[model samples]
Target: MSKVRITQVKSVIDRPERQKLTIKALGLGKINRSVEQENTDAIAGMIRKVSHLVTVEEI
Candidate 1:
């Protein structure tokens, strides 16, 4: 399996509630914070939801 790096590049403030929750769920709340997760369909879907707030890189 492959892994992906999810980095919180932008602040979640003033964003929708869902987006804020999604950021926290991904283990990120502050900008520049990052988390490594397995590259899967579910994770991809989540990333799609908040693509504007995060940057993802395949590892």
Candidate 2:
């Protein structure tokens, strides 16, 4: 299976509550932190929710 590298490029300050929660759910709480996860629809959906705060690369 393919994987995705999700990096937190921006801080969550001043963002909506849901966005903060989503960021945490993505296993990110700090800027520049990256987490590898399976490239599934559920993860893609979560990434989409915080697209403004993160960058994703397929691996």
Candidate 3:
């Protein structure tokens, strides 16, 4: 299965509470922290929700 690398590139401050929680749920709470996760719809949805705050690459 393919994987996606999600890196938090921006601070969560000032963002909506839901987005902040999503970032935490993705196991990323600090800037520049990257987490590898399966490339699935659920994850993709989360990534989309915070697309402005994270960088995602397929691996």
Q: Candidate 1 vs candidate 3: which has greater lDDT?
A: 3
lDDT of 3 at 29: 96
Candidate achieving the largest lDDT: 3
lDDT digits (tens) for residues 1-59 of candidate 2: 79999999999999999999999998999999999999889999999999999999999
Give residue 21's error in model 1 in angstroms. 0.7
What order do candidates take by lDDT, descending? 3, 2, 1
> Across residues 1-59, which tens digit of lDDT does each residue of candidate 1 receive?
79999999999889999999888888889999999999888888889999999999998
Model 2 segments more than 4 A misplaced:
none
**Of models 1 and 3, which has the larger TM-score?**
3
| Every candidate's lDDT | 0.92, 0.96, 0.97
Between which residue pairs do clashes occur in model 2? none
Residues 1-59 of candidate 3: C-alpha lDDT, one tens digit per residue: 69999999999999999999999999999999999999989999999999999999999
Model 1 residue 25 CA deviation in Å: 0.9
On a 0 to 1 TM-score scale, where does candidate 1 land against the true structure? 0.94
